[model samples]
Target chain A: MTSRVIFPHKVLPYLLLVPQIAITLVFFYWPASQALRQSTLREDPFGLVTTFVGLGNFRQVLSDPDYIGSVQTTIIFSAATALIPMAIALVLAVMADKVIKGRGFYRTLMIWPYAVAPAIAGMLWLFLFNPTIGTFAYMLRRAGYDWDPLLNGNQAMLMIIMAAAWKQISYNFLFFVAGLQAIPKSLLEAAAVDGAREVKRFWTIVFPLLAPTSFFLLVVNTVYAFFDTFGIIHAVTSGGPGKATETLVYKVYNDGFVNLMLGSSAAQSVILMGIVIALTAIQFRYVERKVHYA
Target chain B: MPERTEAGTTSRSRRSPWVSHAVLIAGILIVVFPIYYTFVASTLSLQQILRPPLQLLPGSHFLDNYYEALFGGLGRVGGINVWTLLLNTSIVALSVAVGKIVISILSAYAIVFFRFPFRMTFFWVIFITLMLPVEVRILPTYKVMVDLGLIDTYTGLTLPLMASATATLLFRQFFMTIPGELLEAARVDGAGPWRFFFDFVLPLSKTNIAALFVILFIYGWTQYLWPLLVTNSNDMNTIIIALRKMISYADADTQWHLVMVTTIFAILPPVAVVVLMQRWFVKGLVETEK
Candidate 1:
């Protein structure tokens, strides 16, 4: 929607737009277009020759067992990373909402973790759960639990997931708190007047009304798990225990930067680009319909 | 009594207030325990931490460990001290936050306040960038950095990161909410684009700018992967990347004491920012994401 009243300046607007446009073109568009182009081309190991191979990199990347395993890992990682924190946050938000006194105090304490860097969060958890030197790991072994995340793939995945989820809980908690606050009090009061029990009142009134916020957080937490948790994985597990925690983003970095498999990495990057586009589309669609809830 | 019961059920009485506080206190403990343990670990000696099930209480070596961490250079990271890493991180975070605000506000002003050809085209261009995070286009972006000779440079670390859509979109959304009459009144008084921007737009967006600053500074400070790839030298390392360097996955190679110390240092500024600017931080977060 254009503003009805606007300056009729010709060159000034273009001048004003230069810095953002220039940066976007150089850093964002150029690299993205290059990824597309590089995905179709292969460079020889000797760095002496280049050949155009149409769709071959995509074919190889898609067919590779390691790549397939990484995709499976990403799905599991993203789902758990998205859900665990969301569930924890929802419970905390509900509790905070119910408490009449010290609501702000509890919120302040809880939200501080939102500021902790994911890598730092991962490190804290890593130190606490490190099989040999970790405090909790010591407790676990004493209890007869086999707690070596470094040696077991599933255990390693769980560790990173917890670290990732721990960092995200504050974010989801804040959103859920905001969501809970937005529900009309009259609706709940009416349910209570009808002799609906507290749990029944919440299920019949609050949960249904909170669908929009829940849906929005779902999309956001999915995006966070997909892209932003790279730091936690890198710091905590480094996608270890036989690539068990190797997410799509981590694999892209590993293949391109570490292994120098540019063609395959670029193909994987293009596929990631498609995934992001799909997610962004869903988000924008939500934005269009968001006004109804408001 | 019945009236009080009804009133309580409406807002605050789904359960006893004690139950809510109890659950919330437990939640807070779970959230804070890792950091608390890290803090406890930071103050202890290496031998203390190396031994499993370290004491939960504070240690006697707090001053000594902190002194070493603040002044002592990590041997693995080329002896660059924590202070320099903190300074580097501050520069990156401040520059990214300020630079993004400047560029985005200007663009949003142009798009919202002026009638220009291809304006929607430019908006779409910036909007599409939301989908292309550094994770997806890692290699090509790094290539651009190398080709531009920006590797290990401060500009390299912060500039590529500033190329995002969130701030511009946020500014655009805020600008749209501004009353049209304000611009009309300025125009009638013969205020040009530059004058309107400085006098009306800038002043109007003061709170928004502050809010965005809090959020963006944290975003800049917490960056891990991009800085990891761009800066190879210890001298160029931000605090987050430096923390990663100081850590060794192998048990024996790592100094748990110093690592804990650096972890606290790494998190302090951003956490302080969030706590100090809690109101604006929350506002900026909800606004930008939604």
Candidate 2:
């Protein structure tokens, strides 16, 4: 994959690779291997002894009802976070693309939320929806709806979902805009000449053509919801209201750091790693084909 | 052909463009409402915030609230002022951005420019790290940090997160596009690897480097979970982490006005970078993923 003519350095190449390789091994590989090793080992109460229990931790974790609940929570959270913003973004992107004027203006105004930290975004929503003090909460109460995320599990999940989805709309909007632009105007024009209406043409032609981008975004958003929304969960609910908001990642942290269940946490870590591997593999398989779309 | 089709469509549908504009305007309002509400709340007095249906417009207490947040009016978080948190975040961001770029560029160059043994092995080693994000390896990674005595240190904050496989992959992809003639020409001029790297490669990669820096800086600035775990002291907290500490969910005495002010301060820098360097930010995001 390199050039035909290149440097013939032996030591310099290794020297150049040292920093990245070192950091990767120490921080990435070592910890990962440790997770694997620790998954099978259980420590005593006093932290003095580690007895090897092959597959015991994984068996216990899989059987635990709380772990199962967390798995369901992750599934619902990821699905909602992925779909809600994407649907909204597609609508906004189509409208932005259709508008003849202020296209760039709308894009500018809309995209800065991508830059907001998930935690900060969570804070904004929490403040606005704070039951006792929130402006929106006050209005909702006036409108005769019960409003309190702090006490209600379903409401808390909704709050984090809204915050996470809100932050991600800008990213999805950008990609959808790019995807729409990549479709050939000639195709739509051809459909028009054949007596197809605009909305019908979009459904039959444009929507099908955006399949690649849509599929790619599905994978990306899943990963984002899976890993990147840690801040939002931590800040907004801390997996509260009876662990309704704890995703797999949050559970791993809580079990490991907060609850001090080393073996169980390590097992959960290994499970998460498997999930990432599967998701990443799916992404690469799709993206490999989509690479030449340009 | 396309122009005629456009005219045909226009005649078939005399729908007002105002509808599209109105829809987009509504979308923008919803998207921007929370941010604007935060800013307005930051300027109000405690009484104003405590009362429901506070005025939509900003109150007259902007300077007082901000002054209180910035100074030690409310007892400083971890004895560190807002400025300290801001400074710590900036340092982490700049270091992570610069460090990832430098190391990734060098590794990419090494892989692309020279025929070294075990090259693919090393590449795969780095590639595998992508599957092992810090979230999945939280306990073990913290153990490693604790063992290495890097906890509560800047190195702990920045170093573990800097092994960027995506960045290296991007640089490698870009380097593969470099014209072979340039390297041949540099070789003819008797340029060493270092010389070619400094003179030719560095200059040629300026745009890519700039784009990557913008994306990575935001990534660094917005980090929460890692910093939350590694840094225990109040002074060591980044703004994102510090903001969490500032809010007391259970207490009636939580400083609502100051929390709002701190939220604005926490959001401004990265958002400013995104808006200011919009072109490169978009390009960097699109290119890196591919």
Candidate 3:
């Protein structure tokens, strides 16, 4: 009787995963296959005409200047967005971990930006940086600096980066703070007893113990930078100031939806998917091994 | 643990609390100033908003801007009222939240309790989808929506998102941590699986469920790309999409005041959700990570 009961409990986990499995197959695998198929065909506004072009779309995208620019922009955007937020969040998390009072208030306010929709975040930034009416623009003009993100490529990229990082800092902070808290309090005390200063204690005790949390945040933050900021770019810049803000996914949205070049867009999507998958696999295999999961 | 230090030594060893407070205050301001600026900007008129020196105080145009953006004025492109858009967004978000939670619970139970074939294979496949970004499969998913006649409808907007792999994975992991003796005791008491799930399992799983609810609600509410593609008409547009339309129009005409107002309106719902759900939200992340 005990064995029979134990067997069902053991097997139950697998059975419960069925709907997720089915949904993944239908919505994920089926669509992925369809995207792959559509990328090979010649698609017009009216309909798609299927023909196996044997990497023609891929070749066209790889050689195209616009595609190349998008790839470059995406690399820069992802790197900056990921690195900046991680740095800021790490510092904030450490500070928050040290403080005792008003922790909840600080956390609540810090995560407020994350609550705003990305499109809304873009719109708010758009208003704040408006050339004529924007408060930031007014401050810049008063300080003898020309502030026009909409007109300058570099300014536009910087604004987008700032917005993305601001939105993400709270999320990363939450994870980091939690990770910091989970580190046994005794470790820090032990370090302090050994004549370690604050900075030395953090470097020797806290940082080493927080490796797993850091790794998880790194993966999550990278994925977010690569895939989630399309809406932000769409609202704020729309790949504007001469397409300077056109990251890979933003370009995919343009080619696929706005321009109705479905095949080429699908091709771009496939390439992006491949890159993300490869990066993720490499991250898990190489970086995760370094994570000290206590 | 170290020996207890004298009070003087312990107090002297710490940095000045005032300095830490100052740093914290500065960080908090940087995090919160945008929201403050947004609210202030929404209150100002277009001309004042555009003036060389930007207005810092709350302006007289707050009601005017709100009225215009919500009801159409100053050459605003008119469509559904703000109330209607909020209602639509709420309906879609609420339904998606409920559907996702229910499905996640059941699916999690099945996986946690039953003997099933190809279980690990199934789990791996589901895990892989968590890595697949929505942009990759959107084209075909959009086609599926059109094929099933779900476009321009609430059912269409919320259904595809309902069966969330993230929620399932989360719940399954949480369920696995529950004590096995509870299930055995329930079985001995002659409770069926359904009774066991409802009576015993669910009560203990409230924290996880609450966390999942907060996360899913935010995800559903903030969904923009899919809703934009499927719902073409203004009547069907959720707040996020509606806000996008407002910004696009403002971008074309350079109507700063109206844009600010619409942006404020767009942010209110998600902000409300976050404030209400913050506790669960953090708890969920901590649970999942652990």
Q: CA lDDT of each candidate?
A: 0.88, 0.88, 0.77
Pairs in steric clash, model 2: none
Whichever of 1 and 2 has more DockQ, that candidate is 1
Which whole-number lDDT from 0 to 100 does residue A30 have in model 1?
96
lDDT of 2 by residue, A1-294 (tens): 433687988899999999999999999989999999999999998899999999999999999999999999999999999999899998898887677678878988898788899999999998899897788999999999998898889999999999999998998888888888778777877787898887898799878888887888889999999999999999889998889999999999999999999999999999999999999899888878986776
Positional deviation of residue A125's Cα in model 1 after best superposition, in angstroms: 0.6
Tell me the number of clashing residue pairs for each predicted model: 0, 0, 14
Question: How many Å off is the CA of B156 in candidate 1?
Answer: 0.4
- lDDT (10s digit) by residue, model 3, range B1-290: 13323542353237865666667688888777787887888898777766646555787888888988777743443546777777888888888888889877887677667666676676677667765667876778888878889899988888777776677777877778777888788888888787888897899888888887777777778887878878987888887887777767664466777667766777777777787888888888666752
For residues A1-294, write the lDDT of model 1, one tens digit per residue: 543788887999999899999999999999999999999999999767989999999999999999999999999999998899889999999888787678778888888778888888888898999987899999999999999998999989988888889988989998888888778776777777788988887788888887887888888889989999999888878889889999999999999999998999999999999999999999889977988778
Judged by TM-score relative to the true structure, which candidate is superior, 1 or 2? Answer: 1
State in Å the error of residue A273, model 2: 0.4
Error of 1 at A123 (Å): 0.7
Clashing pairs in 1: none
lDDT of 1 by residue, B145-219 (tens): 999999999999999888658899889889998898998899999998888888988998998999999988988
TM-score, candidate 1, is 0.97
lDDT of 3 by residue, A1-294 (tens): 123343345545655565666666777788888888878877545774556786888888999999999888888988898888888888888877666677788888888877777777776666677776666877887889988987999889988888888888888888888888777766777767678888888888889887777777777777878888878898889998898999988888888878878779889889988977876786667444744454
Instruction: List the candidate numbers ranked by DockQ, top first.
Output: 1, 2, 3
What TM-score does each of the candidates earn?
Answer: 0.97, 0.97, 0.90
Best by lDDT: 2
